[model samples]
Target: MQLPDPSSTRHPGPAPYLRIATEEAFAPPEMLEIYRRILSGANVDPGFRGLMGFYMSSPSERAQHIMRCLTDMDALRLKHMDDCGVDMQVLALTSPGVQVMDKATAVSFARIANDYLADAIRRHPTRFAGMIAVAPQDPQAAAKEIERGVSQLGMNAVVINSHTQGEYLSDTKFWDIFAAAEAHDAPIYLHPNSLPPGMYEPFMEAGLDGAIYGFGVETGLHALRIITAGVFDRFPKLRLILGHMGEALPFWAYRLDYMHRATVKSQRYDSVKPLRRQPSDYLRENVYITNSGVAWEPAIKFSQDFLGADRVLYAMDYPYQHAVDEVIALDGMTMSPEHKKRFFQTNAETVFKIPPR
Candidate 1:
């Protein structure tokens, strides 16, 4: 499908618009070598092996560009943001980061990345905001970093990619991460990653492992688990940011509530009692979503209508979507001007408590 060039469609003659993007990503220099080691490791699973091959299949010039984009914060990144008409970005570590590492490696590297991001934000206060990268594998350390990131480093949000090894955030052991977020009122931006081998073996070589099928299914399931596991009840203030337009959950929303009620009411569920609230309630109240990698207008409209526009924010899913003349494409969407304002700007500010520019 053909689309308009975002450059041509961007806000004409920029009157200093405050477009605070909630989900553009970057990988720190310290974490880059760690990933190279992981990727080059011999024991990497077959499904992941295929996904890595797909990304690296890009010609040499593009691969070089991807590496530079992953580490650079000042020159090319800022220039692209300017070109795309993005006034500010809430930057995060790209996927398969600390989640794949052993606890010691994950802990030390999480600090390094978070510190890099914190320093970057300090240097360019107006241009960037940072999300803390905590290693979920170690809950105490993760909680400590959350406090350090928020109170000490001036970071505003937290990001944990969907799973660590095979464990989801819904597991009780990870509740400290949730508690940290609620205590500080920091939103946890749960990004997607490739599925683990056990769950992904069926789609082994069909190219269904990463972003296409695996990310949405695994992330959506993770979100549902958080809801059904009574996570919201424990920490009502804990808010989550789900990317890729709620990972296709908004469309099937009502059915989730209905079906969940039907099964639980019928004693099909093993738990003695059903959830105090319907699943949809948790999604609406505790979750916020970003139109990052997926920018389809219909999906954006549905997310706004279903989840409330206040809970939806704009992002470019950078480096991946980094030709961000593509970022301006969101300007072409046919929403009310008011909705557009909230989508691109205010919602992010209010949600992240970003001080005015």
Candidate 2:
């Protein structure tokens, strides 16, 4: 059951770049308990019920292995990072986070999780940086927590596991969270979760309701929702970090800009509003993406070329899809050393405001 010790397999001597994994995940034990409780309760999203039901009690070895990695914030996690040549992991509270809880519970759990993350960062300042977890169930409270996380707890950013109870951030009720993020200059990392109810059935029937396809579909849709809703225009200073390569947005630049313009012009969808810039312009201007699960050079390079080299950063998607060969593959990408440094190191620093090592 032991994960491979990649230290012996890593390339010898000093690496030319630092690997700051931006989409890495960790969860406090209490959060997992919340998930367990939700499984037996009503009003739970079916997809979440399925996903956690499997993870919590599945006899599958992979599930157990991932559980160990997800719950560990100290020695085991650090050992995995060292083994894989990851210099640092920008830790985030894992998917669904406090978003799955009721308002009161969500708010309280967020505070607890934020403090836990703050402690982890303090314990290993160089090896770890964190994104604040907040419950979007209560946007005002979420905003307050973001302020506290950034100004007081030293969190690098905020992590929202997309869609709170099937409600996307595009809703104006959630704008307070955006306002807080903008004021603090803290980037919001939009991580993925299982599809919500109403949209979960078809995907689940096909067994695609988890990472294979659903996560990207759900999160990409959420990102586009925010873009077309004019959240970026309203909060121009806000920066959004999307892992899995901008949730495939960079790849669809021409289509998004064209369709968005067409939709707005035709007034086909009354919800589509006029934007100050093209949909893709916002991607270039206000968004940064991480190459998390994707290790393919062509996709990574295309995202960089399309979004500008500065916009794409490196990530290991640790404990979930962390593989030594992925790191080697990214290391071998066809790019200048300067670009590589930015890909693996500087871009994360610039986006997350990580201090120089």
Candidate 3:
């Protein structure tokens, strides 16, 4: 199918836009080497080996794969922006976030990653804005880095990968980090990574088919934990953004609300706010969901219906999925021009606070 030309007279200038979530804009040689090591070591599992084989066919192909990964980080991001008419991108640290390491290692890696991202934004300020990566393992350090990232680096928000190395965001231990984020008025964008070791080992043992099924399930549960823990109640201004269409939470929203409403016998915790409204209500109010991996029209429409158009934003998952295809899918969907405008451009601009061009 011929996609509509965003630049055509029918579409006029700067047709709406698309933005990417949790993309590493710069992968230094050292970083690439680290990723190569990880990918190579990740082959301990036959399923992982097969996946890596699909990604890296030959020994000579490793460099190209690494370059492709880096290009996916930067050049391909821009190429997608051009193809999708994305005016600006809110870039963030890629998966597992800074949570996967010990405190010292996490702090060091967060600094390195944030510095690289900051430098990339400096070089392409118009095209990219940054999201700081925090190591919630150390709340005070995370708070300090967040302050530096925003005040010093001009980063717009923070991107956290789903569970903090198995410690869910709702854990009281990380309350200080949430408090700090609330203080800064910066949104937290939560992206997903592999499930913590034993948690999803059953699925992995049966070959990696579970990755597609389980990652979203685990991440969705993590997001739900935040809601149940009343994180939003304490930090009313704290904004949380979830990618991959809220990791499939939108579809199960009604069930969540029903379960909460039906459980009156467990009212022993009367001090809690009673979850007074629908679970989805908190999601609509405190969370912003991005269209990253799932680009289907029905899913988009359902997300907008559940979260509202203003809470939805365009996001190309990148490397995993092509931006060109995402643009074509979105353009082909049947939605009002106004809703499309909000989904494609306006909402992200408002959320990320991107300056108008």
**Which candidate number maximizes lDDT?**
2
**Candidate 2: pairs in clash:** none
lDDT of 2 by residue, 1-357 (tens): 233333436642358888899999998999998888888887677878888778889888788988999999899999888767899999998888988889999999999999998898899999999999999999999999999998899886999999988899999999999999999999999999878897899999999888888899899999999988999989999999998988888989999989888888898888998999999999999999998888878888898888899999999888888678677767777889998999999998988889997
Model 2's alpha-carbon lDDT is: 0.88
Off by over 4 Å in 3: 1-28, 32-67, 71-77, 83-85, 208-211, 267-273
Candidate 2 Cα outliers beyond 4 Å, as residue runs: 1-13
TM-score of each: 0.92, 0.96, 0.83
Model 1 — TM-score against the truth?
A: 0.92
* Residue 303 displacement (Å), model 2: 0.9
Per-residue lDDT tens digits for candidate 3, residues 210-328, read: 33776677778788888888888888889998878888888888888887766544675653346656678889899998877666788889999888888888876654554455566
Tens-place lDDT digits, model 1, residues 1-357: 565454354442363247777887788766766666777888875544565444545567756666678788998988878877788989998887788888999999999988888888888989998899999999989999999999998887899988788898878999999999999999999988878777787655666766777788888888888888889989998999999898888887889989888888788767424777888888889999998777678889988888898999988887766645555557777888889888988898888878865
TM-score of 2: 0.96
Q: Indicate the residue-level lDDT of 178 in model 3.
A: 87
